[model samples]
Target: MGRKVALGGILTAISIIFLYLAVYLPSAKLTMYFLTGIIPGFILVEMGARQAWLLYFATSMLSFLVLGNLVNAVPYIFIFGIYPLIKYYIEKTRNILIELTLKLLFFNIASLAVYFIWTRVFLINITIAFPIVWLVLGLQFAFLVYDYVFTRVIFYYWDKIRVYWRKDVR
Candidate 1:
């Protein structure tokens, strides 16, 4: 338990630092922008999807008061239109990659579309909205990559933890 707490703190530090790197990304390379913001999201999903969403909401509430940024509602945790599609594929006994791919697709394609439409209708200046949208999307995608990689590796250990045993210590 202590080790997990320490690890969580370390990951949060790394994520905050990477999010700080958002300034380095150029307009044309919006993907990088999304990747940085998603670092924390990735860590959240790794711990627990539902709990991750709660953590995301907490961070988002803070972000709003600090920066007045409303992009936090992009629904990164729940993944719009993705769960159903992935479920369809899973029912067919498809590979895990397919599910991850759908997660990416939902965030990159559907959620972004929703965000863009919302920002366009509400925000007066679409120009200012573009960069923010790009960054949010970039973060979502990056988190997906990290989540997929970490999730697979964690599963490996989780599987082993059940069977591994210590010997000669009696």
Candidate 2:
């Protein structure tokens, strides 16, 4: 539908802008990546899984081309960018324990992959002040918080913002 296509285009553009900002603002790179991740959820809710996937691929490719530095898009491409879609499917099982386990499993695996790619492939040196175990634990905790916040934002959009937009579109 025209509405879906328009919204998808808008969200994709917004995501690219965030990715662009992430390149310029080193301190806010993570935040920008997180925001870019959130945009796909809107497409998922408004359009569907297929549309969301399209948006993800479009944004990923555009970010890579526009940024011209794989390092800037690494976190988004590896983890944050695709997380919303992954989360949606994972949560559909409707079992809290299974969902939590699978989500954490995905996070850990993706994170390790990202670390491997970042350090080994990119040759970036990440100097951690503490032990690797502590870093892993901290990352797990942060992931839990991110998941909770992501759910809340989705619910809020569904309950409040989506209502207005749905009416307009109809």
By TM-score, the best candidate is 2
lDDT per residue (tens digit) for residues 1-170 in model 2: 88778888899999999999998998988798889999999889888899999999999899878886778787887789899999999989999999999999999999988889989999999899889899999999999999999899899998889888676654
Q: After superposing candidate 2, which stretches have Cα over 4 Å from the reference?
A: 168-170
For candidate 1, the 10 contiguous residues with the lowest summed lDDT are 76-85
lDDT of each: 0.46, 0.90
lDDT of 1 at 146: 53
Top candidate when judged by lDDT against the true structure: 2
State the displacement of the C-alpha of residue 147, model 2, in Å, after optimal TM-score superposition. Answer: 0.4
What is the C-alpha lDDT profile of model 1 across 82-156, one tens digit per residue? 232233344355667776666566556665575565678455344455677788767777757655654564456
**What is the TM-score of candidate 2?**
0.95
Which ten-residue region of model 2 has the weakest summed lDDT?
Answer: 161-170
Evaluate model 2: give its lDDT: 0.90
